[model samples]
Structure formats: structure tokens, C-alpha cells
Target: MASGASDCHFHGNAVATQATVSTCAAKYQKDLIASGKIAKSWAAVKEPASFEQIDGEKGKEWKVTFKDPAAADKSKESLYMFFTAQGNFIAANHTGK
Candidate 1:
């Protein structure tokens, strides 16, 4: 679904922690597959995701960007997943026209 920029409150200067980010990304990808948005056979997201802290948000919160290989063009199918810093799924969306 199309989303407006106002939907999030992400900020610059994300926390630098590879372990935490990997864990969250794993869970987010799993949840996405479980939700049927991504096929299980695809097995993984097309690229690594970067994490960002949401200003004033409670709990560990991050915004991850990745692509579903089954989707259309990379530009049109770029996907975003939001997760709690502890790796809980929150929301997702597609970018591009």
C-alpha cells in the first residue's frame, strides 16, 4: 500500500549494533513470510536492511528496508519493515510507483 512520509517518525544517526539489527531483520523476514506477503521458498530478503531509531518511541524500534525477490522491479518493489528493537514485527509497506 502507498504510505505517506508522515506515517513514521524515524530519525537520523541510528544506533550502531550489528547483532541486534541482524536479529530484528531475521524475525521481520520470518514474520513477513508467515503473513504470506512473501513466499516461503524465497527464504530470504534480497538485501541487508539498515536500522534506524524512532525518536521518542518506546521499546526497541527500527525501520528496515529490503526487497522481496518475487516482487517487481527493485525500485518499484522496495519494501520497508518496522520492528521493535527487540525484534517484534510492527508494520510494512512498498515504495516506488
Candidate 2:
């Protein structure tokens, strides 16, 4: 799949490309901050620290990680957001595990 393309559909799912997943991850981060679910300091990190595709028991999953240097606790500095191959948000937490 081309990096410029938004996504590719297979079966009924819209499989997201790297660019598409990054956009989705950004939106999810913004929404979390807006909803007060996460610290506003997270906004300081404009870009994700990493993006990864994992093949697990449930199938393909996308992980977007952001490092918030302003976080009070070092353990909570890294925020990990998860999504489905289709770009659907799954969950988020400090521990990627």
C-alpha cells in the first residue's frame, strides 16, 4: 500500500496505512486531552515517538506511542494508544504490555 493513500479496504475493514494511522492517533490524543482523560502536558509532544504494527493472537494491531517529558511521573511519561488494523481505537495506557 502506498504511504500517501489513506487506507485500503479488505473484506469490510478499512486497513489503515502508516499515514492514516498517525492521523487517527493524533485525533485520539487530542480527544483524550479535551475530555480530561489525560494530562494536558501530553499536548507538548506534537509527534508520536513511535508507530508499530503488531501481529498478535487477535490479528494485526497498530500502536502509537507518545513521550510526554513534562509528565510528573517517569513511569507515566510514555503513553501508548492502540488501534485496530482498520483504524478503530482499541485502548490506551502507559504500559504497552
Q: Using TM-score, give the best candidate's number.
A: 2
Clashing residue pair totals per candidate (backbone < 3 A): 2, 0
* Local accuracy of candidate 1 as per-residue lDDT tens digits, 21-97: 55556666776778898657436564554656663256555677765666555553556666655444567766411
- Give me the runs in candidate 2 sitting further than 4 Å from their true place: 1-11
What lDDT tens digits, residue by residue, belong to model 2 across residues 1-97? 3333333222345677778778878888988999998888888888999999998458999988999877899999999998878777788999996
Q: Which stretches of candidate 1 lie above 4 Å from their native place?
A: 1-16, 39-47, 56-60, 68-70, 73-76, 95-97
Give me the displacement of residue 40 in model 1, in angstroms: 5.3
**Per-candidate RMSD, Å:** 10.0, 4.6
By TM-score, how accurate is candidate 2?
Answer: 0.82
- The CA lDDT of each predicted structure is 0.56, 0.81
